[model samples]
Target: MPTFTSNTAQINFQTFGDQSNPAIIFSNSLGTNYSMWQPQIEFFKSNYFIICYDTRGHGKSTAPQGPYNLELLGEDVINLLNHLEISKAIFCGISMGGITGQWLAQHYPDRFNYVIVCNTAAKIGSENTWLDRANLVREQGLLPIASTAAGRWFTDPFIQSNPTIVAKLSNDLGAGSPEGYASCCEALAKADVREDLSKIRIPVLIIAGQQDPVTTVEDGLYMQHNIPGSQLFEINASHISNLEKADDFNRAIQKFIV
Candidate 1:
């Protein structure tokens, strides 16, 4: 793992495979760190240069004070690319990361060849809902949210069958920085790209989870309908579809990128 000092924060990131290979960056969801993309790293390491990073307020990345915005989150990826000296690469993100991808494709279209957003929406939840979650986490810490995260993130059968995986992600959320998480919650509160979707001219792929309660398939369809020529691929999993249906997720990526 390595660190890049962006103008606003220090970003923690890891790279795999040959740098000469075509680049592909993976952005993690909320709560989890760059490690969430382990399955993707293993699968794509041989063919693509994989870049995975912790968002400003998650993982080993430095957590700045107060509320952050989507522009800041989107810029972090751009800064990482500038540091690596890669002109353009494929961008893939899930949840919060997915929303960041939308912002990136809208604002920095020339920097990416393709953008893949998974398990996310143009507007996630109501502003009040996100603000309330931020307040709760800031006051009572991540325990309450982390405890119920599994139910929101996975289907019942997956939770029962993959207790170890579920527990690890849940526990990681519980141990995450409350301020960081809360700030990101605040970011989500104001992040809405529905109106800007039409402005994104680059090729885009939307991956939706059929069973995701957080960001439903309807949300994916909305994005597909908005973006000029975006494609949608649905998997039979929940919020964390990449983890739950690794094979299907990877296949989708391969199909789109190839």
Candidate 2:
């Protein structure tokens, strides 16, 4: 694992495949780490230089104090690119990471050839909902949230069939840094990019889980309608579509990037 010191946080990341190949960076969701992208890594490693990193405050990354914002989150990726000396690469992210992708595309259009945002929304939940979650996590810890995460993350059929994967992710969420998770909740609280979506000139692909309850297909449709020339792909899964429908997810990415 390699670490990059970006501003106030030390970002933990791993890279694989040939350096000469086209680069593609994967950002994790809110609770999970870069390892969540294992399926994507294995699928694309041969043809692409894959980059996966834990967002600040998740996985091995450092968690600084107080609430964070989208600007800080977006800047972390830019800083990581500069550190790797990568002028540009393909960006793919899910949930929280997906929102970060929007910010990156809006602010640093020159640093990416294509952007794929999955299972996310321009504004996400209302500020009150996110703030309440942050407060609850800070007060009671991640247990309550982690215990019910599977319900929100996957469809009932997927949960019943893929218990191991679900358990691993839920367990990881349970053991994550409370302060870090809370800080990100605060970031989501203020992250609203609806007004800025039309300004994004980069090529974009939006992947929405047809069964996702958290960020619904409506949310994905909103993004697709607003982002100029963006395409939308729907998968038959829930929030964590990449894990529940790995083949479909990979195929969508392959079709969009090429």
Please give each candidate's TM-score. 0.98, 0.99
lDDT of each: 0.95, 0.95
Model 2 per-residue lDDT tens digits across residues 1-258: 789898789899999999899999999999899989999999999999999999988999998996999999999999988898999999999999999999999999999999999999999999999999999999999989999999999999889998999999999999998999999999999999899999999999999999999999999999999999999999999999999999999999999888
lDDT of 1 by residue, 1-258 (tens): 699997568899999999999999999999999888989999999999999999988989888896999998999999999999999999999999999999999999999999999999999999999999999999999999999999999999999999999999999899998998999999999999999999999999999999999999999999999999999999999999999999999999999999
Cα lDDT of candidate 2 equals: 0.95
Candidate 1 residue runs with Cα over 4 Å from true position: none
Off by over 4 Å in 2: none
